[model samples]
Target: MAVTILGMDIGGTNLRSGFVNDRFELSEFRISSSQAICGEKAPENIAAYIERLMAETGIRPDAISIGFPSTLDKARKRLLSTPNLEGLDDMNMVERLENALHIPVYIDRDVNLLFLCDCHANHLTADVIIGCYVGTGFGNVIAIGGEILVGKNGVAAELGHIPVRGLTLDCPCGNVGCVEMIASGKALKTLQETWYPEEAIGTLFTLHASDEPVRGFINDLALPIATEINILDPDEIILGGGVLQMDGFPKGALEDAIRLHARKPYPEQALRFHYSGEKQENGVIGAAILAFRHMKREKGQPV
Candidate 1:
């Protein structure tokens, strides 16, 4: 029998779980809302939800991995902070889940998994890889030496929060004018409300190609992408997220901006893009890969 791996992706609004084999085929996957996990009991509720998912699937796995959209310490054992989800501050996530499940648990920021999936699937090996997800919000992950790069404080690779233009707006992380504030879902929403109160969020990009307001929003979104490109000229830069896949996004315009704003040389010429599907299973499969990697490391094998 093939060994199974269980994986989970914990988002602000939903929790997705699944089982996968060595080939990265997902099965018995499930998704459910996370609205009920509120307040002090939030951690326990998450644990309970995982248990229920495993029971429903009836496939016991030797290991489990979960991804969270939050800042982690270099060890990936605790959630240092989650701006969108307030309940997870200072939580010993790995220990709690491992104790409850009696199985090994692995965890990391969700965007890192996107990078891992892209690298593994593409069969590209590089000493440095940078993955950026551009959607309602920006997510960034960097990998080095075939392992997820964790900074000393575990809060490394937070490229989204880098400030730009000093534009003041409330950030979920309690800052103002963060890069996320200027170029995220919330930023787009604010721009729509202020400049084009009558337009829908989805239609901003559609109108942008012709309308001035729409164009402004697109420019804001591109600024940070350009900044990152100039700073880190990775062997590969993977771009995937809801925003990049949106109907009216000016891919040509964005790339133009990136090239114009980024420094000259091979870094500008070598830029590549990969857009994640709306139904992409990277969340679960990447989580499974994390567990598998951890198991290998525990056995004194290469990860």
Candidate 2:
């Protein structure tokens, strides 16, 4: 049986929405500024926005799924914290949105949604996998034995916050010197603004591929990734994000730097990796996948 699901990838900057069917085909994808609908009561704003979009598009979905950039509670009901987005802290979006929309609602970390999209798109099946996305911030997720690995508090796979030596940069998540402070897209933007303001950040790799600053930035990008490789030594790593998808980004150099930092003999020698190849609507489609899967499981259908 065919069914339509409404999926959204909500970020600090923008909101992406789309309709996805059981076949995993995405349609009517749209992006809008997140701020336009944000207010003191963000849940209401989100509900209203969905209502308006669905009314306009005339696609009333069987369920709604959202990918939010926030840590979730152990039960995946309440949002623990949302550093980048405002008006979303400590909210039970599942209850609120379901009440407002009168439909089944599902939510998860945005990167986990990205991981689902990566696996579905690439046809990857493995016992352990790590997804490291370098976008506005460092996003990470891990799967062990074919399940998303959530810690006791449901905030596992926060590899971005792993400590770094010889540095004391305060992170929004608190504490000092989280590797994200130096290894993420934010770090790269800082590097560009400091040293090569004349060149666009997107073109930094193309123009200064051999420059030390750019080269070092790439090396830092490898730091957290290599550290994860050292620890988990995942069967496959799905690397993706806006930074890596940019024109002229040096994928080879980044991979080499990762290998350079990886440990010897064990994890380094036989490491396998692949790119996520994510598209603009990848998260949106992944959200739908999550909803559809949940629906199937409730009906005792094989996923």
RMSD of each: 1.8, 1.3
Question: Largest lDDT belongs to which candidate?
Answer: 2
Q: For candidate 1, what's the RMSD?
A: 1.8
Query: So what's the TM-score on candidate 2?
Result: 0.96
Cα lDDT listed for each candidate? 0.76, 0.88
* Clashing pairs in model 1, backbone N/Cα/C closer than 3 A: 73-154, 74-154, 136-185
Query: What is the model-wide C-alpha lDDT for candidate 1?
Result: 0.76
Candidate 2 local lDDT, 89-144, one digit each (tens): 88899999999889889999988888899988888888998999998889998988
Candidate 1: tens digits of C-alpha lDDT, residues 113-199: 766777777776777677778766788887777766677788877788887675777778787778888777777777879987887
Backbone clash tally (model 1): 3
Q: In model 1, which regions exceed 4 Å deviation? A: none
In model 2, the number of clashes is: 0
Q: Evaluate model 2: give its lDDT.
A: 0.88
